[model samples]
Target chain A: MRRALGWTVVVLTALVLQSTVFAQIKLGGTKPELVYLVTIVLAFLEGPASGAVAGFGGGMAQDFLLNQPKGITALTLTLLGYGVGLLRQYVVTPSPILPVVLVGASTTVGVLFYGVVRFLLGFNPGALYLIKVAVLAGVYNAILTPLLFPPIRRVAKATRANKVFRW
Target chain B: MALRSRPRNTRLVVISLVMMSLLTITLDYRGGQSGPFEVAGRATVAVVGALQNGVSKVVRPIGAFFSGIAHVASLQSENNKLKRQVADLQRRTAERVSLERENQRLLALAHLEQTLQLHGVTATVIGESVGNFEWSITINRGSSSGVKVDTPVVTGNGLVGHVIEVTPTTSKVQLIIDPSSAVAARLSSSGETGLLTGQRGKDLTMDLISVGAKVFPNEPVVTSGYQGGLYPPDIPVGFVSHVYQAPNDLTKLISVRPAVDFSSLEFVLVVTGGSSG
Candidate 1:
């Protein structure tokens, strides 16, 4: 319980900053979705149970903050988190690119699902807009995977003294 | 415990993810019928935002120091943008003063209305939409502030976006730069008209201009004052950033760089409309 709670805290903090100050820091014309990056890391580092739980939680919180339709982020993130957890056993590169690529691919799937749901429900996400956001988010998050991995690993690692930071 | 259990475990994992995601989608479609799990998540976000707000106090001084160093790289663009802002501010101030003088002069003969009131509430940007494709901002006002959907938002400079969603104390503004947002606009300089639509990110596409229209690089844009006039008039939107004209095309595509930096928005004005024309 303590470990799960701790990791959840880290993910939540990263999401907040992802939308606040860090959201403004653009590199190569795209800002990294730190929440999605962190969620992917959580899913991979933890198992499917933890991954889905965290993914749904993170997605709900993020969507709420965004004032977007409820459950949109939750659904999309649950898919990505679970998929990442499953793919964790298959990666061979052992590099940041692997995580980035995986993250980008999954984020694309997630956003596509989200866009379709939105469009069908009358939100009307134009094709031009969808492609731009999905592609750019993938690239940006992929690039930041390396920088994100270490912190995620550190927090996920169990420590006897610092229970709050343990995942 | 056994090889057979491994496949079962995978199935269980996939099933669980699928089930939870489906439930989420259903609840979401029903519009905010949150499960207990989702409630916990929102609380978690609130706490995290609070914690980050505290940590930012520590990070702020360091960030400022680094920003000082970083300012060197951004200095040129910053200087130019600041210069333009200074000029724009001077113009607004002059207009305000002149309007004040005119109001006094007309006080005896006319029943003049006050300057245009805002259509929505004001908000301080607290967050931004994650990802490169979608453009939105989290403001410090929400349902509690009577901020509803599609309320026109603006800044001192020009059109920003409309309100998308609202909570108790915060709301999200979909920037005019997002690919999803479209606003009818007119050129302040040449009076040529166009439809302003969002492009990839932080760039707008002004379309439907006649192929022979004499549009220039720095042609200032404002709201069209048509189509219900969601946005007010004379609000400087952006500059002509790029123009794509191909042979044999009846219309040319012009790209505009918005005046307000959606990426770095800190404060905004929401024009909540309820006034006499």
Candidate 2:
């Protein structure tokens, strides 16, 4: 329970931090999908159940804050994170290369998912834009994974310490 | 086994959703746009707008702080500049105060135009819609201000958008640059007519124009008088930005940048009149 609460706080803090710099720090006028990234990270760390719940919460927060369709991002990211977690066997882990590869793959999957959803929903702006968002997001998040994973993993380890010590 | 099955099914569902969304877009747009999907889309739009408004409210104070810092940094050198500009601004304000009186006079002079004059109940722009949703702006004015949904709002340059919702004290106005807004427009130049449709970002798409539509950059676009509308004829809208005649397209695509910058927009005029007939 304490570990779960701690993850929740971490997620909220990350969101606030992400929103603060969104204006100045955007890659191409769109902020990096922080919620999507977090979902992927948590799924990797804690497996699908916690990740799905976290993803759902993140999506709801985004919807409440961003006003996209109520269930859109929530439904999308939740599935993405859960699906990626399910694919864990295909990737293998605790290695540096795995994180690096997963970041690119996850970023691509998330961006493509969002773009495809928006486009399908009759808001097709242009096809070229989806490509731009996917490429930039994939590259930027891939780079960020290396910088972010170790610290996040440490937090997960610390939180899980209590759980492991009892065993 | 059930736990494993649950996760596996979720993967199937996600992939199916991707295909569903893809199908929704393709079929919806092609099949005259889906009704429920449209309702869902509009709901999403409104939700996004409300969300943007909330975000802007939370973040506006931050913008003000940045502005204040910028103001202070520029103050030392801007002292002389401010002194001169302040005098000019004071004169302009006085002139504008009388101009307000003249504005009423002008409205009265054209009795035919009297039906079209704005009866704006003052509203503060509380927040903006998220992302590139520049086509709509949320205001502190609503039904209490007699701002009904679809009431046309204009700023200094021309038409901004229409009130899309009404609370007791707040409403959201969809801007002219949103891909969703399409206004009947005529070129102030040769009077060539077209529909000014908003595109993503800050630009607008002028449609229904032939491939050889004569257009000059910076020429004004205005709302043409439409039956059963609040906006009257010849209200200035925006300037032509670019003209592109795609080699394979039947109609040319023209870009129009709106006159009133929705980004910096503050006060607006919401006309009392809409279609009563």
Candidate 3:
């Protein structure tokens, strides 16, 4: 319960910032996907199950808050969080750069996946522009990773199971 | 045995979550805009929108500062160009007033409405889309302020977009540059009508011009306001920046530069009522 509550607060705060603060600060014609960044970082700290759950909640919050078509971001972020979490289990690294690299790479793949899903739904924004946004957003999220990941890690640790039955 | 069950349970959780997301997407797609999910989404937007509205007030000045710094180098040249355009427009305004008076007289005699008398609710932009894939903005007005879905939004310069979603306290506007947007427009030069479609990051494209229609660069374009259209008549959309006829094509290919600079949208007028012509 504590873990869920902690992550919920993180996701909600990130959603607010994503829409209000980051939305205004465009870099290379796009803002960093802050919720996407948070999901990946949380997944890295937790395992695949927690990651998928967090992704679903965070994605739904964003989709609803921004009034975007429902479920697209939820679907993308679920797969992304699970994939990153599962991959992290095998690639254990203590380096501080791991979050940056993981976020940059996963954000690129995640956005491309999102573009594909949107294209399938018949909303094509042209291939070149989509690719450009993906790359720039990846770089932007990567730059933000270091700033955000540490705090998320602290929150996760503070909220983890002290006694398994205790809420 | 416990460890084995744990991994299986983890896989089950992931699979279940993925399936749930897929089901949601399917339902939302099939249900269109009137789904149960949309109602709940609107409530969520209202709650989050209130939070966004608060944060925006604090961050807007910072955004403006950064934006000003980014464009500082070109501000002087743009100021000079605007000065020249202002003088030219001042000269033309005198001629335009007389022409407009004559046009009004003719319209009155013919019993036709020349333009929509728009009564608008002014709203300040509070937030924009967080995703890179979409072009949308959120305004500080909604159903309570008489803003509704499909209402036209505009700056003083020209049309910006139309409201796509409205909550109790805020609304979401789908900008004209969004991939899904389409506008019915007519050229001012030859009075030819065509369908204008957005090109994402590029200029708007106007198609279906007849092959025989004379076209020129920089001709003004306005909403056609066809019968039962979404927009009223004569709202400025853009200016034709390029026109060409493809070999053996049936129509001219035209690109229009939007009159409003979407990047700097701060405030807009929402056509609340009385736009009927």
Per-model C-alpha RMSD: 7.6, 7.5, 7.0
Candidate 2 local Cα displacement, residue B30, angstroms? 15
| TM-scores, each model vs. reference | 0.69, 0.64, 0.88
Q: Which DockQ values do the candidates obtain, in the order shown?
A: 0.33, 0.17, 0.51
lDDT of 1 at B160: 82
Tens digits of per-residue lDDT, candidate 2, B158-271, equal 778887656555676887777777798888886877888876655788887777778899888888866775466777788899988879898877788887776556556666
Best by TM-score: 3
- With a 3 Å backbone cut-off (N, CA, C), the pairs that clash in candidate 3 are none
Model 3 C-alpha lDDT per residue in residues B171-247, reported as the tens digit of each score? 99999888778999999879999999888757999999998998888988998888888887788899999987898
- Which residue runs of candidate 2 sit more than 4 Å off their true CA positions? A1-26, A57-70, A87-108, A136-167, B1-58, B64-116, B131-135, B165-170, B210-214, B230-232, B245-252, B266-269, B272-277
Give me the displacement of residue A25 in model 1, in angstroms.
Answer: 2.3
Could you tell which candidate, 1 or 3, scores higher by DockQ? 3
- After superposition, the stretches of candidate 3 with alpha carbons farther than 4 Å from their true spots are A66-68, A163-167, B73-116
Please give the fraction of native interface contacts (Cα pairs under 8 Å between A and B) kept by each candidate: 0.38, 0.02, 0.68
Cα lDDT tens digits for candidate 3, A4-45: 899988987887787777775777778888888988998888
